[model samples]
Structures are given as C-alpha cells and as structure tokens.
Target: MMTYTREKNTQLLISLLKQHGVRYVVASPGNTNTAFIGSIQGDQYFTIFSAVDERSAAYMACGIAAETGETVVISCTGATASRNYLPGMTEAYYRKLPVIAVTSSQPIANIGHLSAQLLDRTVIPKDVAKLSVNLPIVKDNDDVWECEIKINQAILESCRHGGGPVHINLPTTFTKPFDVNKIQHARLINRVTIDDQFPLLEDKKVAIFIGSHKKMSKDVESLIDRFCEENNSVVFCDHTSAYKGKYRVHYSLVSGQEYNSIITERPDILIHFGEVTGDYYNLKIAAKEQVWRVSDDGEIRDSFRKLRYVFEMSLNSFFLNYVGHGTEINISYYETCKAKLDQVRNNIPEIPFSNIWAASQVSSKLPDHSVIHFGILNSLRSWNFFDIPDTVTSDSNVGGFGIDGNMSSLIGASLTNPEKLYFLVNGDLAFFYDLNVLGNRHVGANIRILLVNNGKGTEFRQYNHHANYFGEDTDKYIAAAGHFGNKSKSLVKCFVENLGFEYICASDKQEFLFQIDRFVTKNVQDRPMVFEIFTNSNDESCALEKMLSIDIDKKIVRKNKVKSVVGTSVISSVKKILGS
Candidate 1:
C-alpha cells in the first residue's frame, strides 16, 4: 500500500490540498521535494503532470488555472528551481489567476553555509505573489499550529480579494521516509464577506473584544449597544479600546489569574475588532475555533490561535446583520462577568504605593473631556484596571507596542487640540527615551506627564515573570537598571524646569497626594507640568501579585468556612454523647 510521507508539514500540505479542492499539480524532477512529490504522485485525487523544466512546469500550472478557474499547485525543488517561476507568477499576478507556487527547500540554517542546492528564497519580488509564507518543519505542537496557520493563509490568499498567485516556502529534511499510514487533518479557516451568511450567534455566550480604536461615533456605539442588548453580549475592553457603551466590562481585573472561576467558562463565540491590544491577559478567555474576527482588511489574523471565521465587512454593517435577526437576549454570561468584576473591584487589598496604586487614585478623577495616553506593558496594564470617565478618551502606542515614542506621540496630539487637556502616564525608560519632545517649541501648555521612575524596567521584575528568578542580578542587564542617572532626585526636575515647565517630584504617598491635584486640576493655560513619582520595583511587583490573586484568596476563604461548619457539627455530636 502507498502510505503518506513521514514529514509532518508535507503530510499537512497534502491534506489541505485535497480538502481545499486543489486537484491539478505540475511537478518538476528534484531530490529536495521528494517527500512531498513522492507522496502525491500516486494519489488518485490529484491529476499530476511531470515536467523536467521548472520554468515550463510553472507556466503549465498557470495555464491550467486560467483555463478552468480552479486553484493549481506548482511544486519544485530548492535553489534555482523556484527562481524560474517568477515570470509565470508575475503573469498570474496581473491576470488574477489562482496559482499556488509551492517551492521546497532545505532547512533555512544551511543558507550561508557551504551546502548545495540551498538558496535564500525567503524574500521574493512583490509583484510575483500576493502573499508569501514560510512553513517550519514540525517538531512540537507550536510548530504544528504555526505550519497549519501559514499553509491555510497561503492557500486562502490565492483566491481571496479578486484572486492572485501566492507563495509557500517549505523547508524539508531530505531523508524522511514515506511510511505514515494517514495524513493529519489540518484546520481550515474560512472567510465570510458581508454578502455571505454569517454563523448563528443567537443566545450564545458572545463577547465583542475591541483593541485600541479611535473614538467611535454615536451611531456606531448605538449599533453595538443594541446588539449587546438584543443578544447576550458584552464588550471586553482595555482603557485604550475607546468604547463608551452600556455593556462595557473591564476584563483585565479578572484575567491573568489561575483561580478566576468566570474565566474557565469560555465564551461560545468571540467577535474581535480594531487594531493592536495591550491586554494580552484577557484574550485567553475563548476556546480555539470559537472566534469570529470582523474587519475590512479581510486578512487572517489568528492572534488567539482560535480564529475560525474572518468576516470581511465594516463594523456597523457586520453588527447590523445580526442585531435584529434571530439573536435573543440572554444576560447570564454578561451578568456573571460583571459580578466577578465587582467582586474583585470591591475587595481590592491595600496594595503598596506602586504605579498601579497611583493610577487607581487618579484614573477616575481626570477631567471629563481630556485625553490620556499610557506607556506600553506596565504602565498600560496598570491603568487598565481602573475606569476612566466616558467623556475622557484614552490611547497608547500599542500599535507598535514600543517604549520609545510615548511622549512624542502625546506632544503631537496636543498640537491638534490646543484647548483641551492631554495627559501621559509613562515609565521612566519610555519618558527618557522621548525626552527631547519636551523641548520641542511646538509643545503646548495643555500637556501633563506622569513619569513613574523606578530606575529600571520593572515589568521584568514582576513576581511571576521568568526574569524574576534572577533576583537582584536581573537588574544588571535584563532590566537595564542604573540608566539615565538611576532615578536621581534632581535629574528630571532640572530638565523640565529648564524647558520653562513646572516640575513636581513625589517620593512617597504623602508627597504624591499633595501634588496630584495641582497637576490634574491646573488650567490648560498654565505651564505644561511633569509629575515624577519615585517608586521601587518591589512595590510594583507586589501590587500586581496582590491584585491578580484576589480570586484565589476568595477560594481559600470559602474552603475555611466549610471546615468551620463541619467542626461545629462534630462538637455538637460529642457533647450529646457525653450528656447521655
């Protein structure tokens, strides 16, 4: 019997090709793609044609696809073989033909070494293929998931958005035997446009997750609000999501903890929108194959590794389709989430005076119509736990999620709306990296910066972080400690004051409380201010540990209550026996 190839990626490709309805394959003779070519040459599902020249084989595949309007796979070996497909691929690109060029090569590690038949095929001319993806030789589960998504993405791109040619660079070990009995059924992701029928989300535990988005229009907000009201749905947002609706819930407080009971009850379907999100902790509350991403880009972004459908449409149109449809109001899931959020919010412990505590103290007290931007990771995660006013808008440099451009972006936004207030909460590293922005002559008086200086990248020093294992040694290099004068008391004070700005330094709770109101309530006509609050890494780590473990502590308390009741029952029985 003819068995499948032992190579996992090759087996995956063969399975996907069969399932995606790719029947025509043009093969060129070579040793590098023997595992793939040998497995499919005898498969009854594929009509394989042999061509000695790779150049001719590519044009042949193109001709077959153009004639039948079906997807054609052109397979070739490593090095100069794939170079011959560019002309045909460019022709296919212009004509919008669905041709998938599968170029097999040796493991990428051999590329600059003295290995034969290995070429740098990682990059190619843009006009040749609409999408280019590289597939890893599968070794573990991560590799399997990566290979599956890449292959599915490449295959779908060929026929997506008016059809074009696509490239898949497959790295293979040349000596793998063809002895497997069956091929692994890889996951296939399907795309749905506005014209197609969307999946049924009625009465399901649905949740709409929005990342960093521009301020939504009232009409769009109303559409989403009605959708959640008609269907049992809630909007899970971080501070940057910019969604002011009735069903908004901050999932960050209950996330990233092991004992949060609500997290285990996964949503039936998660509808995702917008750009990058800094809330990596809250994105884990859905099962694989349960997410439906809605976007106009129509590209497959499997961020949670649970992408099952990509709805290609605008946000309003996507929601409007199901708002008045079969969806019924089921508030069980949303209420469950809100109750858990309230429990965590009401029982917040008296944490140390860290960045989190600072944000909690001032997040709700900011001016009603002001704008706020947080630094990436630690600063953003801190503010996400608290709620800002509906009229107060928030954003971050989370699109690139870098640490260097926080203040520069804030200064630029201040230039647009000179009358309104713009506040920035940034870590020391990010603030110092972009310190030159303060000296920009265009900076307005409406800007207020809260610089949390802990003398290091405190995120690396968190209790659960991998770098925390290094103890104080982590400060040597990993956290880049002692940089920029190591949180000098006079460093930032002098810098901001010299630039004709007001400087406020707070080293403890008492100092911060005294100066926070002055910084926030000051008129926009006043000089731009910088409030540099000094904190230590230990307090920052402790606050995050205490907040995330609240649900776990509740569980322990419940167990103790059960034990108390059992002890009372045992004591009553013993007393009754002694009296008798």
Candidate 2:
C-alpha cells in the first residue's frame, strides 16, 4: 500500500512502479523530476540512473529493457526532453521492447501558451507506444485515487499488450509530496486467454519464416520448434534469428534462380514470427500468400496485405496450447530446402579481412556475459553474418539506421549493468555522428569499443553509383566518402586520447589478428578502450560481391535501372546500390 496526499504523488508513483517490478529508471534530472528522483534516491527497490541528454536516457532505457526483460522507465522534463526520446522511441517501437517514458510538463493552465518546456502534451509518438496516457494532476486530495488508477492502467497496458513502450505525461502540479500510507494498490487483472482458433491445415505444404527474433522465451522457442517439426515445415531464420532447435529448419539456403522457382510455386500455408521474412525476396514471396501471423501485439500489420489468420497472443503460449497436439505431415520440400542451404554456406568464398570474418573473429574472443551494443550499419550486418555467444546479449534495434543513438545507449547500459563487461562495435561514421556521447565523464572502465574503420562507408561502396561518382582516383573517392584520407589514424588516436581512452590501431590483417587479444583482454584505464582497425575500402566491396555471387537458393535480386555484374565493375555497382 502506498499513501497519496498533496505534494507526494510522485513518491506514490515510484512506489507503484516498484510494486510492478520496474528495476531501473534512466532519467535526466530537472525541477519537475526532483521529487521523483528523491523518492528513489536511497531506495532499494530500483536503481535511479541519470543521463545529461534525454535521447541517451531513452536509449539507455531501451538497452536496460532489452537486457532485464523488464519495463525500464526514462524520466525527463518536458518539451525538447520529450522530443529527444523520439529516435529511441522509434527504435523501441520497431524492436518491441517495453520502455516507459515519464515526461514532466507544465500544469494544464500553462499549456498552449509560450510556457517554458511546454509542448503539445496530447500527441504521443504514433505507433511507438502501445498506450499513451496523460495523468491528471492531483490538484486536490480527492483526485489521488483517479491518478492511481490511471498509473495502474498504463503499467498493465505497457507490459501486457505487445510489450512495447508507453508514455505517462505527469504535469508539474502532481510532483507534490504526499503521504505513502494512504494509497491502496490497484488489483491486477487476470491474464486473458486468446479464444481465436487457428485454421486447420489438411496435409498442406506449409513453411515457417522465422525473422529476427531476439530474447525469445524458451517456452516459445520450444513450442515453435515442435509445431514446425510436427507439420514437416521448413523454417527460414534471418541473421538476427533467435530460436534454435533440432527441427527440419531450412529455406534460407535457397537463393538466386532456385529461390525464385520455389516462391513461384507457392506453398499452401505460410506462418511468420518476429520482424522481416529474412530478406527482400522472402518478403516479396510471403506477400503473395494468405499469410498467418502470431504476435504479442496487434501492431503486426500485414502491410495492407491481408492475412488468413492473425493470433494476437504470445507465440509460445499460442503454440503450446493449440499446436502441440497437431499431426505431423511428411513433405519432400524440407529436404530440397536443406540441400540448397548447405550449398550456399559451403560455396561462400573465404575472405581474409572482410566484415563478416571480422565479426566472427571478434565475437569469438568476447568474454562470457559481455553485453555487445552494435551500431546500425555494416557493423550490424557483419555481426548478423556471425553467431553471437549465448553469454553475449545485444539490443537488436539496428533498424534505427544512421541514427547514432547506440553509443549513448551503450554508455547507459554499461552504467546499469556495471558488473558486466560491455563492448560497443561501431563503424567510423556512426562513431563520428554520436561523438558527443563520449563527453560523459562517468563512463565505466569495463566498456570496450571496437571501431572498424574502413575509411568510409564500406557498405555504401557495394553500389554502382559510388564507383561512377568517384571514378578511378582513390584519393578523390576516399575524400568524397568523408574519409580523413591519411589523417584517419591520427584523428582516431586524438579522439580516443581526448576521451581519456586507451587507444590502439590495427591497419592490416596480421596486425588486426595480432592485436585482437590485447584489445579484448586489456583493462580500461578509468575510461573505455578503443581498437581502431583499418582495412581497404575496395576489399569490403569485393567481399560483398563475392557473397552476392554465391549460388544460394533464396537470393533476392532487385532490378535496378542499370544492370552490370562484372567483378571489376562491382565497385561501381556498390556505389549505385548504396546511392553514394
């Protein structure tokens, strides 16, 4: 039981959050959140952490949510503070994490005018939060019960419905101190069972398309695997795929002509879980079918594409109850897909110093229980190609491309999980974009950064326009791509030193491999450690081309206006692909 009176609503709110099992709160202190902060300052139920920038605070909350599998709240003042959370909110929305944003604003009377730190309090970040509620200020003692009810509803909606973010806008007047003994805790509602029945499949050719699933509950994965095995289905898991089992999983192997032929001959049923259907080609194929989707939230749209069935329940729960007793079907399609996948993996050309190899090697060296925060870009792609250890957990919001919020997110994650060793793997461009994040003086020594600097956007170089735009001159091309040219190494060293980090550089394959152990095992000196690895831009371009050329079964090809597929001209194609 929590008491609520004038001047103590904020304390009551914190107590309610603790009761609901919120372990952490990432906040940026202001007069508005002072009472809330003070309430949790020495309390044992939750750890209250601060970030100078609200954007970082939100992302930090995102990381905490990803790790703890619990709702993480972010607190900030109004106006720009709310706006700062937009990028992280977008990321959280797509990734499907429960990040509660508690924003403080001016009183209702002061709103709509030129009040400081006041904005449109009603408009929530669309699609970002499952529920957005504006709590009424406790102007009189009589309003406390209503406020308590709203808070309870907000918490339940945020966690129960799809497990995404929620927003609770608290006006300044509600920050008043109150007695903690008078407030009664709201009774939690019973979990609702989804009554919808899955369509019966009578000896139909069905396939399970597994997308980027992260931190799936064990029960969910086991049920899904049993369902697939019983149905004699093929599962196509993407790079970020999380579920693992000894089922007849296939489909990702079929690429190029084989993939096109299989999709043209559509299966009787297609079931999808998580985000994306592996790649563009798979998505295009799935779009043609009367698909069935099982998700926690109703936000899983068919992209205006109609679905045969939509089960809005936890995938694990749905499968365990409905799919466990289904009869097993035998099909030759599974064998064909597995054969194709084997060929693709076997034929993938070995590249000495490509991003894929780099990712695989680095991941291999990471210590147990290391939390990895990778930037969105080629760095993410590289990690996607490799298998991350079970001990290593990452926030899979790489969907927020070109938004340099991961650095701040990593810093905040390190703060929250202080005992765990953390690593941030980012491209040079991503590092440059969020350089301000390094300004934090409280960064822990356990945080290590591996900056894979290929001079410029090596991922962009895979297109054709880049080569055409830069011509044959290497210097001109590097400069056009925003590389520091010969000064890249110096710049990195200077930047690391300025941030009080121990810096080391590796320019070639031998040096990179040689210094990796030192980079991974070396202790940080009161700040984060940075390992700058240098490689040729052309090498990355060539490696991607080789990967694309492999005769896989499910290769998705986008028809560009300009078609050129020669090894030498691949660089031009890369530039064109990246729109460089």
Candidate 1 pairs with clashing backbones: none
TM-score of 1: 0.91
**lDDT score, residue 213, model 2?**
67
Q: Which tens-of-lDDT digit does each residue in 1-580 have in candidate 2?
A: 4334444456457657867777788879677766566556656677878899988988898898898888988888866778888889888888888888888777757876788777886877587787777776665654665565557666766676467888888776644454444444432222234764556666677777666666777677677667766776666554455655544342432432332355533566677667743243345446344566767774434421434455677776667764656565554566667665566667767775766667757876777767777766466655654455665666544454454687888888789866677888877776777778787887878878888777666655654336436544543545346555442768878877887888887877788888888767734445578888877667776665665567633334433313334453786778899999
The parts of candidate 2 lying over 4 Å away from their true place are: 1-193, 210-214, 239-241, 244-268, 276-288, 303-306, 326-339, 464-480, 483-487, 522-527, 552-580
Which 10-residue span in candidate 2 carries the lowest summed lDDT?
Answer: 183-192
Report each candidate's C-alpha RMSD, comma-separated, in the order given: 7.6, 18.7
Candidate 1, residue 479: the lDDT equals 92
Return the lDDT, model 2, position 536: 61
lDDT of each: 0.87, 0.66
| Every model's TM-score | 0.91, 0.55
lDDT of 1 by residue, 407-426 (tens): 99999998999899999999
Indicate which candidate wins on lDDT.
1
